[model samples]
Target: MAVVGPTGSGKSDLAVALALQLDGEVVNADAMQFYRGMDIGTAKITPAERRGVPHHLLDTLDVTEEASVSDFQREARAAIADIHGRGKRAILVGGSGLYVRAALDVLEFPGTDPDIRRRLEAQLADAGLAPLRTRLEAADPVSAARLGDARRVVRALEVFELTGRPFSSFMPAREYFQPAVQIGLEVDRQLLKDRLARRVHGMVANGLQDEVQRLDAAGLREGKTAARALGYSQFLKVLDGEWDADQATEDTIVATRKFARRQLTWFRADPRITWLDWQDPDLVAKSVGLCR
Candidate 1:
């Protein structure tokens, strides 16, 4: 089983409830939650919040390491196997759409060539997103249409160069890698926006800036993936005097709302996910029924 939804939609809590009821353990699919010492900002559930339900894959990386979806696929599958070995259901949970799919779907990532990747990276750095965007548009318009960020654009280009195949061809079908159930939490857009704003403010009040400060000391800026995480990236600006705490907090809220929208878009495309209201009174029961 998998619990997926936008950030701030209470997927973590729901996952915990379902786990306790279903005699299950959780295998995390959230990428950022993989890091140690990133607890509060990632909205990572504490050991107390887990309520003694065994959780796997949390805090498995340092702030300095870049997370890879391929690596996560191997590790998460291993965790699931271990949970099944213990005679417990494995509940995969998180808002990261790609990582969730990577763990539960038959997705294959192409190998990278250092020379090709380095050349692409250099091109992106020297010229900008426009040229890369043009190349990707001509080569793999499907991927180009979906990928807007430079990082992903460069990756698409890299894959095409390496495999001589359009990047979109690698996308997984609706089939699951293993037999499983997926529960999606749905929220009203306006309510979700308000919730994200409040959540960002709460994170700040709960010492998000101080958390960034501590992670910064531990070299968060050197991390490619970790440095760009939503709240951490904004708070890094606060620490650098680029933005005041208020500005950073507001920026984080805006970014989070946007991210939530993207998450909804991604999950909505999958027909396998059974959607449930975030506020459903019988959410756990409904989710468990879907598993049956």
Candidate 2:
């Protein structure tokens, strides 16, 4: 089953608990959580928090390595099959909407063409997102309608340019997984914003800046996707002297809020999802009922 929520929605905590109770294994869907040495900033589940339950697809890659949504889908699907083979449920979790949808929809990405990649990279560098959105709109207005995300739009355009087909066309046009419940954690907007601010502040207190320093010292650059992770990138500005510490923190909070909104939009589109308010006292029971 799938679990999705905003950054500070305690997805990891709920996932761990559900896995333990259901005799299941957790699969990581959050993009940043896949990278090793990104523990604190990614808010990765600690060994203790895992409560001896198995979790897959987290910390299995180096920070410098690229993790495409396609790669995640393959790995997550394999994990789920293995869990089913072992007679245990696979608790798919985290807030990366694309990864979650990929696994749940059993998506098949088109093969990449190097020539297309080069051209798309050039377009990204020169004309920027506006032209990419225009291109996606022209190729597949349906897919464009489904995505307001600039990043997804660009990626779709890249796929189209390479294959002469809409990226959405690559998705399996029929059901894959037969039946699995989807649960989404939710919070009031003001409450979630407050929680996100506090989480950002906590990350700063927990050496998020020092983590950025370590990553930078280890040769991660602005162009790399890992370096572009929310708090990490903003802290890079602080290190570069482009922003003061306070400004850096403020920027992270604002960006996080925006990211959380996007996550909400993505999760809300799935009719299978059962929303659980964070404040619900019966959350465990409700979540368990979903699984049953």
Candidate 3:
């Protein structure tokens, strides 16, 4: 089973509750939660919050390392296998749409060529996203339309070069690798925005700035992916004197709201997910029934 929704929608809490009641373990799919010492910024559930439930993949990476979706696919599947081997159901939970699909869907990742990747990366550095974006548009307009980041654009271009196919051709269909259920938590849009703003303020009060400082000292800026995470990136600016704490907090709130909307768009595109009200009184029972 997988629990998915936008951040600040209580997906983690719901996952933990369902796991506790369903005799299951949790497999994290959130990309940023993989980094250690990113607790405050990532809203990582504490041990107490986990309520003695075993959680796999949280805090598994250092801040300096980039997270690879392919690597996550392998590891998360292995973890699921291990959970089933122990006669326990695996509860996959997170808001990262692609990571969730990569873990549960019949998705195949194309092989990479170091030389091709290097050439693309060089072109990106020299000319910015315009050249690569233009190339991707000509080669794979579908992928080009969806991907805006330089790293993803380079990867898409590399895939096209290596496979002679559009990167979007490899997009996951509505098929699961294993029999599973997906539960989506839904929230009121305006209320969620307000909650997200409050959540960002809470993070700041909970010492997100200090967490970023520590991670920065540990080389967070060296990790392209980790450095650019929503709250961490904004707080890094605060530390760099680019923005004040209040500015960073507000920027984080806005970015998080945007991210939440994107997450909702991505998850809602999947027809397999069963949407449920986040405040449902029978949420646990309903989720368990869906799993059954």
Instruction: Locate the minimum summed-lDDT window of 10 residues in model 2.
Output: 171-180
Assess candidate 3 and give its lDDT: 0.93
Question: Model 3: per-residue lDDT, tens digit, 36-96?
Answer: 9999888999999999999999999998898999999999999999999999989999999
TM-score of 3: 0.96
Superposed by TM-score, candidate 2 places the C-alpha of residue 33 at a distance from the truth, in angstroms, of: 0.5
Candidates by lDDT, descending order: 3, 1, 2
Overall local distance difference test of candidate 2: 0.83
In candidate 3, what residue range of length 10 has the lowest lDDT sum?
Answer: 120-129
Q: What stretches of model 3 exceed 4 Å from their correct place?
A: none
Report, for every candidate in turn, its global Cα lDDT versus the true structure.
Answer: 0.92, 0.83, 0.93
- The sequence of per-residue lDDT tens digits that candidate 2 reaches over residues 86-189 is 99989999898878888888567777766776777788789777777777788988888888866677678777877888877886643545577889997899
How far residue 234's Cα lies from its native spot in candidate 2, in Å, is 0.3
Query: How many angstroms is residue 239 displaced in model 1 relative to the true structure, after the best TM-score fit?
Result: 0.9
Clash statistics: count for each candidate: 0, 0, 0
Compare the candidates by lDDT and give the number of the best one.
3
Write down the RMSD of candidate 3 (Cα, Å): 1.3
Error of 1 at 48 (Å): 0.6
lDDT of 1 by residue, 60-177 (tens): 9999999999999999999999999988999999999999999999899898888998999999889989999999999999998999898889889999999999999999887889
Error of 1 at 34 (Å): 0.7
* Model 1 per-residue lDDT at 137: 95
